[model samples]
Target: MAKYVLRLFDDRIGVKAQGSLPAENRIIFIADGSATVSAGGGAATLAANSAFFSAAETTVTGGAEGAYVLRYELVSVPETEHGMLTGENIFSELLLNASMELEPGDGYLMRCDRVDLPPGGIAYTHTHQGGGIRCLLRGEFHVQTQGKEHVINPGEPWFEAGPDPVLAWAPDHKPGHFSRVMILPRALKGKSSISYVNAEDAGKPKLQRYTIFADEFIAI
Candidate 1:
């Protein structure tokens, strides 16, 4: 298998520039502003919450007012016949293989939102029922899944496997913010997207394993 490379890029442009993708495939998420990405005679204008895939060796040209992008260089993993059910990469702690199958004409539901936290804020442990990708827009965020942790900074991208338990925190020095694009099932149940691991964890101390933030909320 090939190794994956994750990178963060921030571009503030007054004029257009040339670009190219050298990895096998690169997934890009736009964090802010607007930009035009042209390749192979096709062009796409991207804004916040937008994402696109550029194949390897594609020559791209673009211009932007102000934009930050999170790029993931990914290699396709082998199929189940190869004997592996899950994998890990720089993008995520646990990349669990999707456990469900889609039927004919089935469609996926997408939920996009911006989640922000005050300085020294904490998000109680929780889980999402479907997979998603998140990109840090400002400050710093500490993401703990299961027991492993990863720090995500501005312009960086991270992944969520949906079923795994997760906790997010803001470092004491500054406020934190990020955007997410989640893929959920169309027939999903419930009025809320999140499933808190323990309702009791919500009232714990700030330094405890879980705690609630005063200004905590998600904008969908």
Candidate 2:
């Protein structure tokens, strides 16, 4: 079975659509603008800095013209296959949109973590052992990765390739909060899944990092 499936929806103003999820634990990230998402007579608005899991099929109505949503269809791997499987891709279809690539992997362990920061808090420069997506929930965060800076506000989502060093900072006056899902490998399966890099070490060559193969990603 495939590890996960990803689809990007770019909806114009007044667009309404109905769709069903392949799995119950699908994740929906709002990359831009707002949308009214309803299912089974219940509805919620997801915009910048917001995300939610759908345990069933859902209907989505675009909030305005030119809005987009990133949908992740997550599937869990058997622990026996990967030593102990844990986290959760769309690679090609996303190429025209986001600046991320799906890493090579035979299978993946899906893990999600809720992160919170205090005013003036900094996550420091770090890297993940696996690739995944992050969604900002509240407050403000400044994320610098791969030499580009992104201000992740509420309802906005970002992706990391797991090997690149990243710097995240909360504003000096307020706090920051977000959640991330990591799609990691079972090799060295018991490791913490995260690595930290110091400012001074960032410029150094030959920093130790794992390898991800091109064959592991899905071809368009």
Q: Output the TM-score of candidate 1.
A: 0.55
How far off is residue 44 in model 2, in Å? 18
**Candidate 2 steric clashes:** 13
Q: Backbone clashes in each candidate structure, one number apiece?
A: 0, 13
**Candidate 2: residue 116 Cα off by (Å):** 0.7
lDDT of 2 by residue, 158-196 (tens): 777788899878889877776665556655344567666
Lowest lDDT sum, 10 consecutive residues, model 1, at 211-220
Q: What is the TM-score of each candidate against the true structure?
A: 0.55, 0.51
Q: Quickly count the clashes in candidate 1.
A: 0
lDDT of 1 by residue, 81-123 (tens): 2211121211112222222332223343444556778789888
